[model samples]
Target: MFVHPAALCESDQIGPRTRVWAFAHVLPGAVVGADCNICDHAFVESRVRLGDRVTVKNNVALFNGLTVGDDVFLGPNAVFTNDYNPRASVKKTEDDLLPTVIRDGATIGANATIVCGVTIGENAFIGAGTVVIRDVPPGAMVVGNPARHIGWMCACGRRLDADLACACGTHHGADPTTGGIVADDA
Candidate 1:
């Protein structure tokens, strides 16, 4: 569904029930999944893949070579870049671009600038205005410039206690080998 007649949704790959809001421009090769919300003035570049139920807020610019997993929350004006050294005079091909991956259930707060080639792990929460320069571990809550991990988050979006238990009744612990968060059934 295109919310505004002015919105240019050129993508035939947009799934059913997705909403592209005012002034949003979804390029032809972009793939937006079902029930996704692309808010006003957002730009989805070609070859970008947004999984189901992703929330891209106003003025967000999702460049090419980025893949957002299911249920991701991209706060207003969140930026995803593709080039590490973007020179206006140097024309770069798609092969020269870097890719960024936002894992399932991750929340990138408003105005965050995510540098390309980084993987934001599942259920990670990035604070507003933070600039992410590296990979974020799963279930980690990071704030401040360059985004340091302050704590862990539950899949339910609640902060986990020191005991690694969330009020939502989910238990998560660090995976020593991978450095990612994992559900602890035991």
Candidate 2:
């Protein structure tokens, strides 16, 4: 039940356990689900919709036309822009707006900037400080700017080894090698 002084919202769909922190604003038409944490200084625009168990950390902004699925972890300082190309003096129309979607169970690390019109797949993990300009596949793990898929990640956010396996049951059990896990399945 923690409410920040700077957050202004009139949305009626906020879940029970969600906390809105300092300087964070959820606009009137935003829909946020249960147990989501909107951390410090985050801005969620009116058209943004967040599903259950989403975690939006400090300094993150979800502009209009963004849809975040359930169990998504948006790391600190992550940014999403609704426009693909913009000049400081240009006025864009709704037709020019792009939608950014983060699928279920995705984890975006700190300082990641996801460009418009990208759909991050389910359970994909994007490392910190990465810049994503393309769609990320499900269960994939990517890092660095323009984010190349380096490996696969478990739904738990553990990076799978080169053997396409981990100590976790996911390594040698159900859900094997689905996230572009390439290498020896040792």
Candidate 3:
């Protein structure tokens, strides 16, 4: 892992080829995966788990109980909360903090606030400035303050058509179990 001179990465578990940029602070006990790019001014607290090829942009704060899957894109200024009912006077343990999961290939847009205990499914796209209060289905595109599902997103990051077809030659169908979109060949 390449940690910039101005960055403070106290974790010894960062994977190979990961770069922690300037002004970023990755505390001890954080597990960062290979080829991850943690940009400037980002704060990764202990107990966070990041998968390979993740991109954490500038000004993002990833608190405890966050598990980010491979190829996830966390846009600039994205905020992740661990506690749903936070109080300055109350000191909560790890068990008291709710866990948030960002599945593989998901993209969290800039300034988005992801509330605790939500599972963002694979390849989900969260629009900029959106507030996510619940679980997001796979291949779904969400926006606005409560994170309404506006449309479907292809794994290549394009908006899918009404028939769930993409110009990239991918076809998606609904998964009955999760009520989420899934690639036909997946």
Q: On lDDT, who's better, 1 or 2?
A: 1
Model 3 TM: 0.99
lDDT of 1 by residue, 1-186 (tens): 555788999989988889998899999989999999999999999899999999999999999999999999999989899999999999999999999999999999999999999999999999999999999988899998978889999898899889999897888777886587888973
Against the hidden reference, what TM-scores do the models get? 0.97, 0.88, 0.99
lDDT per residue for candidate 2 within 1-186, as digits (tens), equals 456777776677788888998778888889999899999889988889999999999999999889999999999999898998888899987678999899999999999999999999888899999999999887788899879988778766677766656656565333443433322352
Candidate 3 local lDDT, 159-182, one digit each (tens): 999999999999999999887999
Q: Model 3, 181: alpha-carbon shift in Å?
A: 0.7
Model 2 off-target regions past 4 Å? Answer: 171-186
Least accurate 10 contiguous residues by lDDT in model 2: 177-186
Which of the numbered candidates is closest to the native, going by highest TM-score? 3
Better of 1 and 3 by lDDT: 3
